[model samples]
Target: MSESSPDEPPNSAAVLESMTLLATLSTAAEVGKSVARRRLGRDPSAQEPPDRAAIHLRNTGRTLMDLLMQLALSRVPLDHPEEPLPHAVRHFDLLLKLRRAERLTQDMHQRLLSLYPEVSSELVEEARLLRNKIARFWETAPSDPDSPHLSDVLEQGISFVVWTRHEVPVE
Candidate 1:
């Protein structure tokens, strides 16, 4: 076993925790995308203007997925012993933001369903499926040592959040 400096963390545990957080974030992004797709499908009629909330949600989800994909496919390394804890903290912070976004999206979905009662059942069912998938993903722990570091993952997530905010111009 390699000994870490006093200021550095135990590498294995920190790496595992960071990977797990990234997995959860990836799953959350997938759920958001699924929900957004369902919402977008609600209004098939071209006569009505597109739903801004749905559009924003879709854009946000897509942005998240893009970031996750970029991070996963990149060659960035997480081998630094001193970087894990800060990365973990940033990941945690981003996770909170993603959760907040999900909640807001859910609220928008509820409001949309209320406005159009006929579309309620299908959209709700779709959302339910997505939530179940996310839960399953969350239950799975990440054991891959080759996974990217927390800083890289957090950077991607933050970029998505910033980009989406600009693209959608929504709260």
Candidate 2:
């Protein structure tokens, strides 16, 4: 359809936001796959069984990839000031969880540290504490299915990762 045609849907700012979201999700998928293949040892015939560390790392990466895709699909431009913030916060939580798992891997953590110098030693310690808190929350999942505090914790934890000044590629 012609861009100027009245019958054509207007490609407003929201449409650009959707495109950007799609691109970010595509990049996340590529990064997640690379991390899994390298860290998890995709070769089925590998001599050693994947350790708990490997399993957790792979699971976290996979979860982040899924969450990123969900965020892409769920996003919309902030057209109305009164509207709730985008659910990208959930994706941020997943990213933070994956980052925690990455921290357990010395190489991965160091790579991230080099790339994001803002993650100081103190911040790393804080992340460890937050990880424990999230773990504790999970332990009481059944009892806290609708816990308001859980949502608040997740939102605050995710806000840090999501608001970082990194440029994620779009495909």
Candidate 3:
């Protein structure tokens, strides 16, 4: 792939959104792996449980937000669909808010690959299935796009993840 020069203009909004989402998904994957390690009960060097837990949880939230952004951007197939920028930004913001307290499950890995094979080199079907599940959840419990409740979930999830990380005793 050719790299654009610094003076070059931005690509279409959809492209930009896709790139952003990709970056976020990568981060989420790393955090998810950390969470998986915690799930297996590996203890880290943080003296306090809460502090250690908080660190893991924050990483998980950051990771999920990225994946969510990727999903939202992929929803628009058109090269430069009208309003792609706003929709992409809105979804990106929402994922950042839904931030989970726990790390992503192994299912996340399967799903991500299934959905974005170009990025994951793994089965895309897994990600596609997970994506569908999320779409269904939203369809069933639709909320105001601008509600703070979503962010609250992220905050709570972060705490939960951190606590779980602590539960794993040092080996």
Best by lDDT: 1
lDDT of every predicted structure (CA atoms)? 0.48, 0.44, 0.45
**lDDT (C-alpha) at residue 148 in model 1:** 44
Q: Model 3: per-residue lDDT, tens digit, 42-103?
A: 63322334334344434543566555445445455545457565556555554443333122
Which of candidates 1 and 2 is the stronger one according to lDDT?
1
Off by over 4 Å in 2: 1-118, 144-148, 163-171
- What lDDT is obtained when candidate 3 is compared to the true structure? 0.45
Tell me how candidate 1 scores on lDDT. Answer: 0.48
Candidate number that wins on lDDT, 2 or 3: 3
lDDT for residue 102 in candidate 1, whole number 0-100: 43
For residues 1-171, could you state the per-residue lDDT of candidate 1 as single tens digits? 767899865676767687688768877896887689678775322223336554645564565565444544443544664765756654454444444444443443443344344334655444444333333332331454544444444454445344334443233
Evaluate residue 127 in candidate 1 and report its C-alpha lDDT on the 0 to 100 scale: 44
Off by over 4 Å in 1: 1-82, 118-120, 132-171
